[model samples]
Target: MLRVRQWLFAASFFVCGASLASTACPNFFVNGSNPSIDASLTTRTTEVCHTEYVLLASGVTKGPLYSAQHITAAQVAGADSISRTGSFHQETAIPAADRSQTSDYTNSGFDRGHMTPAGDESTIDSEKESFSMANIVPQDHKLNTGEWAKIEAKVRDLATNLGEVYVVTGPAFDPDNTPTIGKDQVAVPQYTWKAVYEPGKGAAAYLCQNDDSITCDVVSLNDIKTLSGVDPFPALSSSDHANPISLPLP
Candidate 1:
């Protein structure tokens, strides 16, 4: 059954309150710039700004081409309720023709992988907004349930230790045109990449295969920019860029 994941962690810092005070989420979308990179294939794309995260959606791909968000341990804590907030739903903000339908993943042997995970949102609205199809990608079920999930948890752990974090995650479509799923021809990404930045500390990037092998590696942000042309946060200081981070998932 598809259900929300539970999180348990100890606060190294003082728990000032039961939840994070409502504050503005950080803008990680390169100064509110459009997130589209591959314009040739992305004929109809839109930027769907949710409460906590922003998604660059592609109608051609039937899914989000990219997503960005601010993550914090306290925010995760506040959102991790015993009950799930929302089920999967089509995004009405975009035209129906420009959105992926719930039926797209049905019996497709793939999972509706969330770029900005529902668990990362601190409020019901944000959590519910996460279910919009514009923020989903067709990913291998094994990877979704395995290493990717582990990596997300580890990110939360890092946020807990570091205070706050910014992340940009998206699919890496094949150069030879990715495979399709469902009748809508939703593109199945061959690989996925996640860019992470923590204020005052350092930044790291991770690339992982979308298969069941659980093979993922850290790379340089410039490498990602060169390969994928995705410069998630342009305003970030250059000094914060760190060498390849080796964070092995348990």
Candidate 2:
């Protein structure tokens, strides 16, 4: 029954997009990329410890991969979720290769929290894909499912306001590669994110490493800044990653 309702929601969203094809795609990015922008094509898959993470095509696993969509869906800031998953850029995460091996579970017990979330998706299929195990990981219950999810929801609203722009999100690495787990059920790392937004640009980005949450981890927003002054969408530069300042709105 729940599955049927979800599919119905997804189908309706698809119809709405097709119905509103005349709407324009907006773009927003204040200023420009900082001089130190890494330009490493942050859009592609990146590793979050145990292994660099990337979106893989259905039924295909291993090696280099990218999400199903070249673009990511972003929402605007608001008290509630504005544009949910129907935007459809969100993708699922893959499971660890081996749990027995610490290195295999390199992200041992780490949750594969999404840069973009399924609940934030605008359509049902988009949301369904989010449920795929490929896009999951052991997460710190607190961060992955709580506040962090809130930020993901805001990104969707931000995108709704801006129109269209590039987005690239993943985890914030601790040069040392350390992932912290929650009370045997959640994972909490240095940070989780929904980075990227041009205020007026409909585009935004998100990134987060998995932790140890039995369910999805929920980290609240502390309003972290994007000190890099460059877009992590195309690629985050070493300098930008190193210089994260304050979030634009906060």
lDDT of each candidate versus the true structure? 0.69, 0.34
Query: For residues 144-226, could you state the per-residue lDDT of candidate 2 as single tens digits?
Result: 66656665555455446555333334333232343443222222333344445343323333433333332222121111222
Looking at model 1, residue 35 earns an lDDT score of: 35
TM-score of each: 0.81, 0.41
Model 1 per-residue lDDT tens digits across residues 44-145 = 867777878887777877887678887777887786653566789989988877777779899988899998888787888788899998888988889888
- The CA lDDT at 56 in model 1 is 72
Which window of 10 residues has the lowest lDDT sum in candidate 1? 1-10
**Of the candidates shown, which would achieve the greatest TM-score relative to the real structure?**
1
Which parts of model 1 are misplaced by more than 4 Å? Answer: 1-26, 29-42, 237-242, 245-248
| Superposed Cα deviation of residue 111, candidate 2 (Å) | 5.0
- How many clashing residue pairs, candidate 1? 0
Residue runs of model 2 more than 4 Å from their true location after superposition: 1-112, 175-190, 199-231, 235-250
